[model samples]
Structure formats: C-alpha cells, structure tokens
Target chain A: MYKHTTDGLRTLLNIPDNYQIFFLSSATEIWERIIQNCVEHTSFHCVNGSFSKRFYEFSGELGKKAFKEEAAFGKGFYPEKFEIPAETEAICLTQNETSSGVSMPVADINKIREKNKEALLFVDAVSSLPYPEFDFTKIDSTFFSVQKCFGLPAGLGVWILNDRVIEKAKQLEAKKVLTGTYHTISSILSKAKDNQTPETPNVWNIFLLGKVIEDMNKKGIATIRKETEVKADMLYNYIKDSNNFSFGVEDPAHRSKTTIVANTAIPAPEVNKKLEQFDLAVGSGYSSYKEKQIRIANFPAYSVEKTEELVNALKKTIG
Target chain B: MYKHTTDGLRTLLNIPDNYQIFFLSSATEIWERIIQNCVEHTSFHCVNGSFSKRFYEFSGELGKKAFKEEAAFGKGFYPEKFEIPAETEAICLTQNETSSGVSMPVADINKIREKNKEALLFVDAVSSLPYPEFDFTKIDSTFFSVQKCFGLPAGLGVWILNDRVIEKAKQLEAKKVLTGTYHTISSILSKAKDNQTPETPNVWNIFLLGKVIEDMNKKGIATIRKETEVKADMLYNYIKDSNNFSFGVEDPAHRSKTTIVANTAIPAPEVNKKLEQFDLAVGSGYSSYKEKQIRIANFPAYSVEKTEELVNALKKTIG
Candidate 1:
C-alpha cells in the first residue's frame, strides 16, 4: 500500500524516480523535522502568507539561523527578487499558501534552482497538489497533508526528499549533530527500505491513501487537474465580477487553484450564516480575519456543478 | 471526544483531577519528546529489556548524559540495588516490558521516589494501561498508546503529566535550553488550554478511543481487571504445568498480566501456525527470540471465554 501510494502520487505529481517519500504525522511536525534533517545552519524561506510564515517560525524555534524574504499576504514571491544568503543550507517555499490562497508558479520554483544551486529547495505543496504540475526534478523535497487534496481525514503527512537530502543528513549525523531523536532521515530511509516506519504509523490512513490514489489513477491525473482548473476559474471569475466580493490575491496568476480566498464587504460570519442557510459551507478567514474574508476549498473532490451551486448561492446572498 | 476519553480513562485508571492528559502521534515518539521537554542533563533508565533500552538510546541521541542500570530480559528492576546519580533530571521506567512480558510492580515505582527525590519519574505504560492501577501522585508522568489496551487502530498516544513536569519544562525554557521545536510541553499546554492539539491530530482514532473507553466504562473496570487476572493465571498455570512450555519470566511476581510470554520446545512460528489453524492468532516473540518464544496479549478487549478457547487450543496443540 505504501509503495503503491507513493508510485501513484509520483506519477500524479510528475515526481522523479529518485525522490523518496516518507510518511509523517502532520505537515506541522514536518516543519521542524525538515529543519532537523535537511538544514545544517541557515534556512532561508520565501514567506508570502501565514502558513509559510509559521514554517519560518519553526526554523527559528529550533535554533537555526533562519531568514525569510516576505511578500504581502495574498501575494506570491517573485524569484528574481529573492536574495537568499549563499551560506543557507535549505530554501523553503510554500508552493501554495492555504491560509491566504496565494501560490507560487512552477517557473518561480525552477528559478530558485538556478539562483541557489547549492541549497536544498523544499516546497510545501500542502493545499496545491496534482494541480500544480510541479517539476519535481528541480526541487529537493515537497510535502503535503493528505486531508487537503486527497480528501482524507487529518493526521497523515507525505514528505518527499531527494537523495541529496539523505546525504546531507548522513553528513550531519557523522558530525554528531542532533539531527533528531527519532524519524531522522537515516531511520526513515532505512525503515522505508522494508516498507515500514520506525514507529507505528497511521496505518489506516496510509491504506486509504493507497486506495484513493489508485482510484484517482484509474480516473487519470490530467482529468482531475483540468477539472480543478475549471472549478477554480469559475469561482475566481465570480469573485472578479462581483461588486460585494473581490479576489484575495489581486494577481490572478498567483492565486491558488485549491484554496480560493475572497474578501467580503459584509461581515464574513453573516456571509457564512447566509451560505449555511443554503446548506453551502465555506471556511471563514483564518485567525484575525475570521469575520473579514471567506475562504473556499476548490479541490478535486468539489465537483464543477457543486462549485457552480456555491457561486450561485453566493450571488443570491451577497447581491 | 478527547475529553470524554480522557475522563473515562482517568476514572478507570484512578488518575487524579490535576493530572493533565495530552495526545501525541505514537508511544515511540513520546520517548524522545519526554527527554527533550523534561530532562536537562542526565536521565537514568531502569533498563530490563528492549523498550526501556530504546528510551535510554533516545536520551543519548539528544546529547544527554544517559545512564542505565540493566537487568536480564524478562526480569524486573530491584530498586534497592539502584545507584542513580543525584544530578539525574529524570528516571525512566517501563511499567511493562512488551518485548519480554515483564512488568515493574507499582510497589517498586513508589520505592524509586524514596531514593530519587528530585528526578521526575516517567513511566512507559504502553502495553499496561487502563489495566495497571497506577498511583498518579507517585509518578510525575505516564504515557500509553491506544492500540494496546483500548484495542484501537495504532496512531494516537496519550501522555499524562503533572504540574511539576510543566514547571521543569518552563525552567529549561527560561535557561534557554532546547526543549523542543514543536509539540514542546509549553506548546502542548498552551494549545491544550483551548481544548485543542498543537497540530492536526488523529481525529478519527481519538473518536474511536473515546467510544471504546465509554464501552469499557459501561462494562466497568473492576470486572475487566478481575477477568484479566483470571485469564493471566490460567495461561501461566497452563505453561507451568505443561511439559513442552514454561513461563518466560522466572519470578512469577515480575510477569506481565497483559502480555504473557512462554518459552516453547517447539518453534514459536509453529505454535503460531497451530493456533492459526484453530482460527486463532497469537504473536511470535519479538526480535531475537522470534523463533524461540510465543507472546500472547491479554488485553481488556479479549473476553475470558475467548481466552479459554486459546488456552484449550494451546493445551491440545502443545501436547
């Protein structure tokens, strides 16, 4: 099941043959574990939104020399403007920022490889996957929690890393640095060789993931991506033309295809209540914006017709 | 659901009102986190078997001064012989050695308090709880995984700690020591105040744990404990009187009431195969003894009548 799921996801995301996949408890835990295994001293992050910013804080908390080039919330980072320190060991990028619905283009991720040829490039594809058409060869690692795109319950996170990431961990372990207590890169790699985890994993979720990905495989990744794109467009176009609502990310290219954030003129809770009356549920703005913005998840599972119903419901309530 | 489960377990286990319960990913992960959050310098482990030795190794992995007083496999630690260093920040104990089926009596745990007044007492009740009637006042912390006694799918771990454990973490944090990155005692406490976990947790498993514990509550803990004792005695007596089998632990007092291990003249796999033929399954011995011994789990979920069937099958097959 583990291998089948990895193979299916690799084929779905265009991941190369050499990249290794590891299962973790959650994406939040991966923030610290990635720093422990992959980073030696400095970690440079491209923080455009809340989720990316939280990852940045995790590096600092772990006593790493952490630096970040920030963009405004709901804005994506431009690769050309990123002035990462040459001494940085890892360059962290959130491919899609779920909190604010901003996403980096595949081109920007590839450009990072050209700029920082030495540093390991890690991407957080938490909200946007199977939709991003990511060229995994250009990135050292990419990870996501299954709940977002795979439409599974929370608890399992998928971490992908290249051989280079493993080698770096080997170097650090040889240097007698505290890479981690358990779930170190070496332990993870050794366990994966046996199709096992160092600890008792979320076996149920892993099984479900394999089955879901196989089902997705039969349906094909291209079809899911195309449908996701159409649904995202429908939602974005509706927000664009509405007087009472506006797209969170002003630049359309930077908008996430999975999580679509909309700034509402009315209180977000009132909007949520109105939508609930129609039995259409959308997420409230995260953190402080809980009453200020409406966040809608437009994943592969949310069909085009259902998204259209949401748009229609919003049109009636907001207008 | 978490609160309901915790409440049920506390009532069943005789846990006090002030002790806090926090959920983690696995019992294995708890080994490292316990050292990180509670231990500042030295940790002394009463290593009678594999699991306790693994916890000792975890302390060493995190650059701590780790010391262990060893006992032979399937033997319990004698507190009178323990010469623990006064500077030890924590004393680790495995209440039940899952690998060897040996349990540290609650009396010995109280004796440790007499010797080490300063060090926090940490107990790994992974395979023993809500069966072990632990006195929470004597121990600073204890943890268990739901897959053991609760008979749930593996994923969630429950860490029970007292106020002193929190104070120790705060002291370490104030001293600028590396307590942890995320899921630190401070972080877990802060989030748990809001009745939430620090990250996205195993929601489904937690729900299952709550439901299972409620069912156990309806049946009552006293009746469960009495049944477990009777089943354990039945199995032990069967091994002792049999020509082909004998108890793994030499001292009857040290034997685990939950996991019962028996050395068999026949290969462990053969024993397992014979049991499988009866439409019953038993675990082979762990690791090195995999071919030499049989391990049987006598958890709360295993009914007395079912246990009797297993004993009867063993009687006919071994003879």
Candidate 2:
C-alpha cells in the first residue's frame, strides 16, 4: 500500500524517477530529520511565519549552528535579501506558509538553490502540495502531509528525497555524526526497498492516500492545477472587492494559490459566524492575527461551483 | 480528540494519575526516544527476541553505552541473574515478545525495578497491551502501538511515562546533552499542557482509539483479561495434545497469553491453508522461524466461542 500511493504520488506530482518517496509521522518531524541527517554543523533557514520559523528552531534545538534570514509573520523572504551563512550545510525553506497564507515563489526558491549548490535544499510543502508544480531537480528534498491539498486526515507525511540526500547521510555517518536511528535516511532507504518501514506505519492512511491519488489521477493533475488557479482567482477577486476584507499578505505575487488569507474589518469570529449560516467554514487568523484575519483553503476538495457559492455567500455575509 | 483518547486509555487501563499518556509515531520510535531522553550514559536491555534486541541497538545508534542481558530466541530473561551495569541510567524490558510469543513475567519486572532503584524502568508492551496489568509504579515508562491488542490499524504509538522521566530529560538538557529536539520529553510535556502535540498527529486514528476505548471500557478490563486467559488456555491446551503442533516457548510460564505460538509439523503456510477452509487465518512465524511455526493473536477482538471454533478447526486440520 505504501508503494502504491508512493508511485501514484510520483505520477500525481510529477515526482522525478530519481527521487524516492517515503512516509514519516508528519511534516514537522522532517525538520528534525533534515538537521540530523544532512547538517554537520551550520544549517540555514528562511523564516517568515510559524512553520518556517520552527524549522530554524528545530535545528537550534538539535545543537546545530542554525542561522536564519527572518521576516514578519505576514511577509516572506526574497532570494535577493537572503543572507545565508557561508558554512551552512543545508538550506531550509517553506514553499507555502500555511500560518500566514504566504508563499515563497517557486522561481525564488530555485534561485536560492542555484546560489547554494553545495548545500542540501529542503522544502516544506506541508500544506500546499498537488497545487504546486515543483521542479524536482531544483531541490534536494520536499515533504507534505496528507491533511492539506490531498484532503485526508493529518497523521502521515510524505518525504521525497534524492539519492544525494541518502549519500549525504552516509557521509555524516562515516564522520561519526548521529543521524538518528529509526526513520533515518539510510533506514528509510533500506525499509522502502522491501515496501516496509522500520515501524508499523499508519496503514489505513496510506491506503486512503492511494485511493485519493487514484481519484486525483482520474481528474488529472493539469486540470486540478488549472481549477486551483481559477478558484483562487475567483476568491481573491471577490475578497479584493469586498467591503469587509482585504488581502492578509501585502504582496500580490507572494499570495498563496491554495491557502487564501484575508484581513477583515470586523473581527474574524464574526466573519466565521456569518459564514457558518451558509455552512461555509474557513480558518480564523493564525496566531497574532486572530482578531483581524480569516483564512480559506482552496484545496482539491473545493470545486469551482463551491468556491463560487462561497464568494456569493461572502457577498451576502459581509453586507 | 487526543485528550479524549488519552483520558479514555487512562480509565480503561487504570493508568495512574501520576503517569501521563502521550502519543508518538510508533512503538519503535519510542525506543529511540527512551535512549535519547532518559539515558544520559548507559541503557540496559533484556534482549530475548527481535523487538527487544532492537531497543538495545537503538541506544548504541544514539551513541549511548548500551548493555544487554541476552537470552535465546523463544526464551525470556529472568530477574534471577541480571548483570546490569551500575552506570545504567535506564533498564529496558519487553513485557511481550511479538516475534517469539514469549512474555517476561510482570512480577520479575517489579523485582528488577526493586534492584535497579535509581534507574528508570521502561517496558515495551507493543503487542500486548490491555492484557498486561502493569505495576505502573514499578515502571517509569511503557509504550504500545495501537495495532496490537487495541485492534486498530498500525500508526499511532501511545507513550505512558511518569514525572521522573521528564525530570531526567531536563537534567540532561541542563548538562548540555542532546535528548532529541522534536520529541524530547520536556517538549511533550509543554505541548501536552496545551492539549496539543508538537506535530500534526494522526487525528483520525486518535479518534478511532477513543471510540475503541469507550467500547473496551463498556466491556470492562477485568472481563477482557479473564476472557483472554480463558481463550489462551483453550488454544494452548489444544496445541499441546495436537498431532500437528507443539509449544513454541519451552517455559509454560513465559508463554504469552495474548500472542500464542506453536511449532507446526507442517510449514506454517500449510497450516494456514488448512485453517483457511474454516475462514480462519494465523500469522507465519517471524524471521528465522517462518517455516515451522504459527502465531495466533488472542486479542479483545476474539470471543470465547470463536476461539473454540478455531481450536476445533485446528483439530480437524491436524488430524
């Protein structure tokens, strides 16, 4: 079942043949893994919202020399302003910051990767997969949990990495560095070879993910990507014209295609309460923006008609 | 939802108020956590089977001084002659060996605890939970994945530990020792205080576990344990006199009540094939004993009547 979805995910995401896909507990666990397996000393991070900033903190907590180029909660890091340490062994970035509804553009991520050729680039696509067309060659690894665009419950995380990532862990092992014991890169590789994991995995979730991938494959990736753009555009255009709300993220280019955040005039709870009347539920502002912002996910589960209904409901809701 | 299950588990198992129940990825992962958080220098393992041996290996992988009192496969260690190092900070034991169908007597576990007063006692109850009425006061920590005995699909692991385990982690942290970053004991406590986990957990399975616990509580633990013993005795007695099978574990006292194993005259698969006609299935022996043995799980899911039917089918197939 692990191999079935792993292969389906490869086809669904256009994951390269060179990359190996494995499962972990969650995307957050991968933060510790990247630090343990790849970084020997210094690791760098592009910190913006809660999740990206946590990657940096995880490195620091592991006694690694962690350096980061920080940004505000609703902001993002640009490749032009990145000040990574010269000794950094790995560069961590979040493709989509679910907390702030901000996305670091894929082109910008590729630019950072080009600049740090010697370092392993780890991308956290935790809440924004199947919607993003990643150039797999540009990054050494990328991971996501099923709760996001895949629309399953959140227990299983998919880790996609190249052979270079495995070799990096081997090199660290040879140098007597502790790259962890269970779910280490080498263990993942060995267990994956047998269609097994070191531990009894969440078998149910893997089976569910395979079924989801089969459905998505039937719908087609290009079509899903196109529908995501159209729905996101519809919601963004409606929120732009609404009297009650404006964009949560300041930069239009950095706005996420899957998670759309809005800065509301009224308290976010009131907006949620009004939306509840129409049975349209969206997330309240995360962390510091709890009072003024509302977040909506434009996942595969949301159809064009449903998104249109949401926009129509918002028109009546805010007024 | 995590709290709901954690609370239900406490009630179902009569887990002490002093012991905290938290969830992890799997029981195997907890082996790594034990080595990291509790063992600052040395960990001792009672290595009798595949799973128990792996716990000792995990300590070595994490750069800890690992010591083990070894026993042969399908055998168990008695507390009569333990050569545990004085420097050992934690003592590890597997209450039930899934691979070998051997269980360490809980009385002996308490004896070991009495001898190693200063060291934390950790129990791996992976395949034998809701059956072993543990002396939680005698053990600092114990863990089990929901797949076994709990009768759920594998993925989530439940870690039950005391305040002393948390204090040990803090002491290590104070001394500039690494006890992992994501799942360090202190982080589990801090996040658990907020009724949250550091990672997005398997929310669905946790919910399922709560539902299962509610059912188990309805049945009552004492009734379940009695049923388990009754069913196990029926199967073991039938196997002992059968033409085709004999006891897998030499010592009757060491034979597991939950996981009952037998040495088969035919290959395990042929036995399984014979049983299949009666709509019954059993596990092939793990690893080295795969050909000559069969393992039957006597979990809460089994009824006395159903077990009798299985026993009757075994008779017909063997004859």
What does fnat come to for each candidate? 0.75, 0.88
Error of 2 at A319 (Å): 4.0
DockQ of the candidate models in sequence: 0.82, 0.87
Q: How does chain A of every candidate compare to the true chain A by TM-score?
A: 0.97, 0.98
- Local accuracy of candidate 2 as per-residue lDDT tens digits, A3-40: 79888998998888889898888988888898999989
For candidate 2, the docking band is high
State the fnat of model 2.
0.88
Which 10 successive residues of model 2 chain A have the least lDDT summed? A77-86
lDDT of predicted model 1: 0.88
Model 2 over residues B212-311: C-alpha lDDT tens digits?
Answer: 9999999999999999999999999998888888899999989999999999889998888888889998899999899888999999899999999999
| Regions of candidate 1 where Cα sits further than 4 Å from its true position | none
